[model samples]
Target: MTRARRALIDLSSTSYYHLIARCVRRAFLCGDDKYTGKNFDHRRRWLVERIKLLSSVFAIEIAAYAIMSNHYHLVVKVNRQQALKWSNNEVICRWYKLYRGTPIIDRYLRGEELIEEEQLLVTELIEKWRARLFDISWYMKNLNEFIAKRANKEDGCTGKYWEGRYKSQALLDDAALLSCMAYVDLNPIRANMANKLEDSDFTSIQERIKQLQSNNVYVKSEITHQVKQPKSLKPFGIRDHARTLPFSLLDYLKLVEWTGHHIHTEKNRHILKGTPNILKLLKIGGATWLEVIKNYSNHYGHFVGSKTVLRAHAAKNDVSWYKGVG
Candidate 1:
């Protein structure tokens, strides 16, 4: 049966999502033609920086991301409670920062003289803008538009640079969410872009690793996470270490590392080719990792490793995701 189209995403129901956006040209933006070029290296840095900057402005959180040549993927969890509580004026104020102000907006902020009725109209307009500010469409619109313009300028061209709309998938369960994330992080490996997740440039995993290593922060699997994670860990992969949020930054990082390593193992290679290995590993049903272990080894390895190494690799995944987005 055909599936019903999703009504507008209800931020209230769930903030987490797996989003994918691709460029218009078949293979123009990425791969050997892209990420490696001297001119475009900054583009990789651009994506990570933009994600860090934008996530601050919006109530969205990025969990996992992989910036490939032709396309990009992001897993985000929206902070619905925070967004819903924003005052109209606060929302409008934030929205203004993303785009240039119009005459009406400037006049309002400047406290210039205006009729009582005119003030009311402006109030309504701002309310609308505020609502848009919290919406994903607005976030993606600004993100995409800004990059497109920058890319166009760099290429010395002026025209539609991206496709019409981005594609989105609902991560219905932890299995789906986790699998998608692993898929994103494994992008470079699958494409032969990098030998391992750590070497994958411009990814969120890499960023997380660097931060953890530089400082005394927990950035590994559950076996390693002794404390909670920040809110940014919720699906928004990027965040300043200073900020705090729900969940153990430590434990969450641990989980991703555990799942990720399993995904990259030789036996799981078939999954990259669309086999059911991922399903089994997550144990949706008959789907279980134990079976793979039996087939690939004598018994299930079941997350046996060093926390530091595991975390380092996972952080590398995060960093690469952010870096590659450009």
Candidate 2:
């Protein structure tokens, strides 16, 4: 059964979520349509730029992303602590970037005097915006609406451009988080759209690769030793730290490289190489991890985590059964 977004998203359970927004009817609305020979590649850039801008405006961080032909994947982390720390004025400023504030906010920003009642009203509005500034639903709404408007206008028609609603999957542990991030980063490779990470356009992995290349350390030995991930992404911390992705950039890159090769290889008879140590630390079997990434959507529905975490989340939600996750 389909659950409400509110029920599925619990910051207490976990802050990270993987989201997907697909074009209505699965049309080639954002890429080339071979049947029609219509290229809408520019639409991909619109989403990429907007996502980057919105991440800065909202208290959300983009951990991984892949903008595909008709859909996009995002691994986002909502920072409630950061949003709570913002002052009223700061909240208004951030909200105003994406939307025009109400007259009361205008007056507040202009230093005009407000009666006590109006002051209270303005305070309430600020509080609401502050909460919304960190809300995943609000963030997706802002993102989808912008692109929908642009695509509708360009197509000379006005109707639904996206599917009814974006899908969300909760990542409740390091194993789930790591595999989902890799799945997102390797989307192009899986689709045969790009053979190499650097060739994958409009993806976070490609962005990370480009950043390293610009600094002249694109070689494997150097990247494995020293290349820091771009600041635009949530850095995979070098140590096993609290409240962060648990692997270093080097390990992540190597894992992606190995996984990408397996995905591209056609022969099933080839002997599989040994699993990376990171998977062992996470207590995920190597073959199971690969299978999860290979058919990510099939293995998860609403929540993706360890068996214990899944059981606990279901119990907390009063759900008698939780399916599709191991």
Highest-lDDT candidate: 2
Q: How many residue pairs clash in each candidate?
A: 44, 0
lDDT of each: 0.57, 0.85
Could you give candidate 2's per-residue lDDT for residues 206-308 as a string of tens digits?
8877887788775365354345667778876755555456787667877888888877773675556877668777777767777889988787788898778
Instruction: Name the lDDT value of residue 224 in candidate 2.
Output: 48
Question: Which whole-number lDDT from 0 to 100 does residue 51 have in model 2?
Answer: 92
Point to the candidate with the largest TM-score: 2
Q: lDDT at 89 for candidate 2?
A: 88
Query: Candidate 1 regions off by >4 Å?
Result: 1-8, 34-39, 112-114, 217-264, 267-326
In order, what is each prediction's RMSD in angstroms? 11.4, 1.8
**Which residue pairs clash in candidate 2?**
none
